[model samples]
Target: MVNGPSTQMAFVEVDCLPTHRDLVVATLCRVPEIISIEVSARGRDLLLTVVTHDWTALSDLVLSRLQIDGILRHRTSLVTDIHLEASDWRLDALNRAQTLEVARIEVHSATVPSTVTPADTALIDLISHDGRIGFAELARLTQRNASTVRRQFTRLTACGIMKFRCEVSQESSRWPISCTWFCRVEPGHVAETVRILRGIPETRGCFSTTGESNFMFIGWARSVTDLLRIEKEVAQSQPTLRFLDSAVAFATPKRIGWFLDQSGCATGEVVVPTFSTPVSKKH
Candidate 1:
């Protein structure tokens, strides 16, 4: 749920030698760049969500750090545009009245900024691990006054550099199947194509990426059979969109900062992303 300003994210497919799959998964888990790891069923062995400070850093991660033993091959797709995020989606728990009431609330307080300071970095580092950490505790950890910490936290959120999400075990949530679709459409119809995908109820996230498949999206399904229905719906919605490939996540070892169990429940462990250098303030 935590993100940084100027962060670059990519979806990397890794094919591990069958015998070394467990070992490889364990090794990749320790890398901070590898924010999320999923065992895929249809296309690749592992699907990874990696974030870096910039494109150069991302290239270094894919070319050097990710070149570990037991990984037979890997492919990286850089995200160019994000149409939707998981945090933006909500479950169908609320009724009409409750949903309308919640929607009426204003969440944004401060104006978004394009840069962050050292103070922002400290706050982000702490909240990235525990989003619920209080202002007092954050002050104690960061060695700043509580009031200042609160102000800085507000600024960070306003800048869109700090965001929070509550993640639950997908299995427990009943939508156990996680699928990622790779598709492509004419450049002229990108906006229309994304609009059609967003109308699908199962869609969790949609993004434009740099690859043979320009569009990628995620969907959570009640069952494998439901995937067919969703795919058909997508095809019917946008005839020009071509499906390059699709991968179903059989297991997710990590998601964002939380380490998930086999049932997709958090194990109370977190891996906060490490920024190699503090963000410089723009003049």
Candidate 2:
């Protein structure tokens, strides 16, 4: 059985020159530790979620690789937890097969109890490789019968251990820009802030993390004007929420562990790190 990742995860926010954007993305994508990269529509900034055994080493490596004249600045935050606000897993079987009209939202929060089982690991690995993999194929990969696989799948979903998502291309969907908003709210206001952000129609994912800016969300827009309108609406509605920073994804090479093709379908490459704690031995 494959042991899940036992180390900390990091979400690094980066800003660089638009001209060197491709070069920076190409370099970072080659690093195995980087699980996914979301580039802004203007190609001036990026958000990288990296899984590694050592946070310090990973941060240093990122700085070294991206430190250039075009590189304006960067910051790395240790992700304490990840919360899935919405995705295909939250939908019924029929909805899971339908195309997504918006971006999926995942929030990073403080550490929580580890929820990993052999079956959960198997399901995640298989689905990460193929988001739309059917039950029969999943059974074949996990060495279980169809019935057992289906039962485990249901259990995993119920327990919130993992979820599957079907992403559509921005061009096809007519939402050409994807933006992630990092907001710092009063300690007691975090939950309310998240709720407000999630309620927005543009919100694809909403997350709470460990840092000054504890709330984050990904929202979609058709253009810069539309994005500004969304932000304006949020500001007027939620005056208590302080906006920290935002990054627009021009290209997403990988999202939620699936290596994406130009059209945003899974490309058979899964970089998702498993999280499982070792079982204690009895005396």
Candidate 3:
């Protein structure tokens, strides 16, 4: 059995200085098992998903280190996860899912049957880490041939089931990091508006929903003013949309397509450190 990361996801309640939230997240990224972590609205809480040898060890780490951060207030719930092990067949099936049936727009439906295998999934997970991992590294990790891995990568990307991009980490620039603005768009005109939204290079991710915000999207802005320009462009492009609310995330504890959690299991890369206590001081 792979026995890798087959545990449940968790939502941890946390409170901290609005100024220090990002710092806290950057710190938590050290946890080895956590696949993803993100900040939420209202007080302060971080959504975390991690793998465990046993769920109990996972719980102790959460309470002992994360909750005691002095800067954080921690409340955790291990969400029920019925999904089984990750498989290439499952992913290929998802990609093969019909267009109208596909839940997200980024997932364009396919006509051909899948050619992906378990080795391919493993390889993609590897290169996805640095966003620039070479084929030889992936083959070594998954024990597959280099040429085979390259073919799988091309097919997977060509199938739209995976993606990779140059990371714009804060270390690269002092300018404000980019963020996406999710909107509670009124019903109707959903499809029409998405087309307009994608026209902009700043746009990175987009999806429709049935919640108060029916459509969600991410875009990059160099500054507050640039952010507004993107918004204005959105307004002008989709005049029919009756916008309800918008959330401008100054800092993202998590990215839109971050399959990797705090830990780097998605890529079988580095293990992100973790604290098993509250994240911030709850005032």
Candidate 4:
């Protein structure tokens, strides 16, 4: 859930010992730094989204910490800049008026303290488990006044430490295939290339990174054939963009904080991210 330039994020592809696959996954689930864990269909065993305070912290996690017994080998791609985040993904479900109404409330609570407190920890943990929990229930669980819980909830969302999103099973949605592209864009054309990709409706998130590929994006498609069309669209728009690799996710066991079932529905099993509680907007 961390953002801004001070925060470090990377996608790591891990190849685990086949005999210990299940054990490896269970162990990774407990690592606070590991966020999104994808069980790929092929080419890799697991793909992880890991976050840390800086490059040094990231190196420590990747080089030292992630070298678990079952993990045979791994590749890390450090995200240098984020062009489009999941929060920026628009489903276009809300009309002008309804969107404006929601914006008004968000604007009112736009500013919050940069540092987290003990009270914030309790509130964050509760909400991370169940986003639909009522303010009264949160107050009861956190042992804070109802009004105080409400204020803290607003502040958490406003400061970008936590985000609320509504997701449906990709199998049921119009775009059923989940695609990720690892690409490299000429340094001078990075911004324009990002602009082009962001305008494309299928894009879920896009980032500029350091590794074999300098840019990468997650996109959705109606069918396997459509992936070629997306590639053509990007190639046509930015001739300098080169595709180094691509993947189609078979199953995502964990995303953000929720553990999903095969159908991509939340299973009520939550792993409240350890770093999410005290994310500092400033270093």
Candidate 5:
């Protein structure tokens, strides 16, 4: 089991030839640490969510096993905080209010059980494919009654084991220019810098990670001009922040365990592989 709330997480971007996509996914899914995998719409890269008790071993595994010849490049960022934008719900007012309401929930120390029951696993498998599935549908899929399934769903959400969010596609969103920013901030200013980034309307997600450039954020733009403008505004507003690099995301094939189709809709299919053996500690 994970060491409770202190479990460390990392987001990795893997760039590879299109031909190696499935191979890459298959290889990564076999690794016990990877929790989620996403493919870009363009199909050239993948995003992975990894959980580990030891960052050093996890880094070694990623660098050795995941960086095959066909793989062009890969970048890993440690996640300190994650902010999800609810663009699909179109409930900006409600979302903003709920965001504040949930502010009391600690970010860095949220505990996710390292082990789960079969029922819990089934529920997670079903919901990951379709976060909006009706209770009746979930009951049928999980071989449980509607009431039981509903209770399980509620419990999972309440415990931070699961979350339901709107996934918007670049082609459909008003601000379609999606990019990830790798940033460096003054050691003392990391918290303030992340706060400012989260407050930006275009910021879809932001995180603090371990590395030379210790921060990363995802932002959207309506056009190249808008993207540049946003970048300039952020730079001006937070003088302590420095951009190390940025990468444009052309696609997101899988998110939070759901496999996405060409139109960027969740296919209600789970592609992330599971391991029968418990995760072993390298340290």
Candidate 6:
């Protein structure tokens, strides 16, 4: 373990009320130090690789802001940090998280394949700590074929169940991808708030977790200032929400999707079926 105020990416687990799920995720999106926000089976949550010195802040975020609306229970764990991203560990962890439950795979298991298992849990910790890896690096991490990695990624995203996009590093790129930040809302209005948020074209994912914040939200913006303006507008628009604090991210450390699991990681463990596209290619 990296001693002192610094951390080595530990998985944080939060048990949230199903209704408050979306609100929790939407709130965490803007936190600057948070590396990534994805959904999974450990229950709906925003798994973040918090900066080593900033881990305490994460606790405050979950408690003060994330403890409202529909949230019921909150738990935290220190699963091993994998030093990778969600997309990179998708297939490998899926096989491992599942293996913990049974001696063999069965067709009738009720669990969705997308939730992060203990095996992937370790990878999640790593991505939280280091979300800046590539396919070649990930291939080496799991010792898998590059073709297999590519195929799994394409299949997962094409199915519309999950996806991973290139995120430019902070200040390195003139134009960064669109995004959002959040503040906690009163526990009663989470559902209403989410309905409004999802109505926006840019909002991508949301979740509820432990700490001062009760929610985390992420979305695309045309520019940095554009995202800031939107966050401000949201505060004014939702009076019942009781906004507490917020942050805006320039880069992420890790994330997960269908190639790794399902839409749950991005959207609070909501079951999303595989994407079905009309065939346009010649047979």
- The TM-score leader among the candidates is 1
Q: lDDT of all predictions, in order shown?
A: 0.83, 0.65, 0.51, 0.80, 0.65, 0.44
Tens-place lDDT per residue, model 3, 1-283, is 1122333344444667677766777666666555546555433445454544446767676766575443556655454422221221111223445734644544343433233345544654465455577889877878878898887766665554454333344323333434434466555676667668656756655655434445556554566678778888888988766555444443444432343333322433344222111123337
TM for every model, in the order presented, reads 0.92, 0.69, 0.51, 0.88, 0.70, 0.35
Colliding pairs, model 5? 39-253, 40-251, 41-251, 41-252
lDDT of 6: 0.44
Model 4 RMSD, rounded to 1 decimal: 3.4
For each of the candidates, give the backbone clash count: 0, 10, 37, 0, 4, 51
Ranking by TM-score: 1, 4, 5, 2, 3, 6
Any runs in candidate 5 off by more than 4 Å, and if so which? 1-7, 13-69, 72-75, 80-115, 261-269, 272-283
The lDDT of model 1 is 0.83
Q: For model 6, where is the 10-residue window of minimal lDDT?
A: 270-279
RMSD of each: 2.7, 6.5, 11.8, 3.4, 5.9, 17.7
lDDT of 4: 0.80
lDDT of 3 at 205: 53
For residues 77-158, what per-residue lDDT tens digits would candidate 1 score against the true structure? 9998888988877777789999889767625635546556677777777788777899999999988899999878776655
Runs of candidate 2 with Cα error greater than 4 angstroms are 1-9, 15-24, 30-33, 41-44, 51-73, 79-120, 261-269, 275-283
> Cα miss at 45, model 3 (Å)?
6.7
Residue pairs with backbone atoms closer than 3 Å in model 2 (clashes): 39-249, 39-250, 40-248, 40-250, 41-250, 81-109, 105-204, 105-205, 107-207, 108-208
lDDT of 3: 0.51
Error of 1 at 271 (Å): 0.9
TM-score winner between candidates 2 and 4: 4
lDDT of 2 by residue, 190-277 (tens): 6666666666767776666778877777787778789888888778877888888888876788765556777766576666653334
Model 6 per-residue lDDT at 223: 78
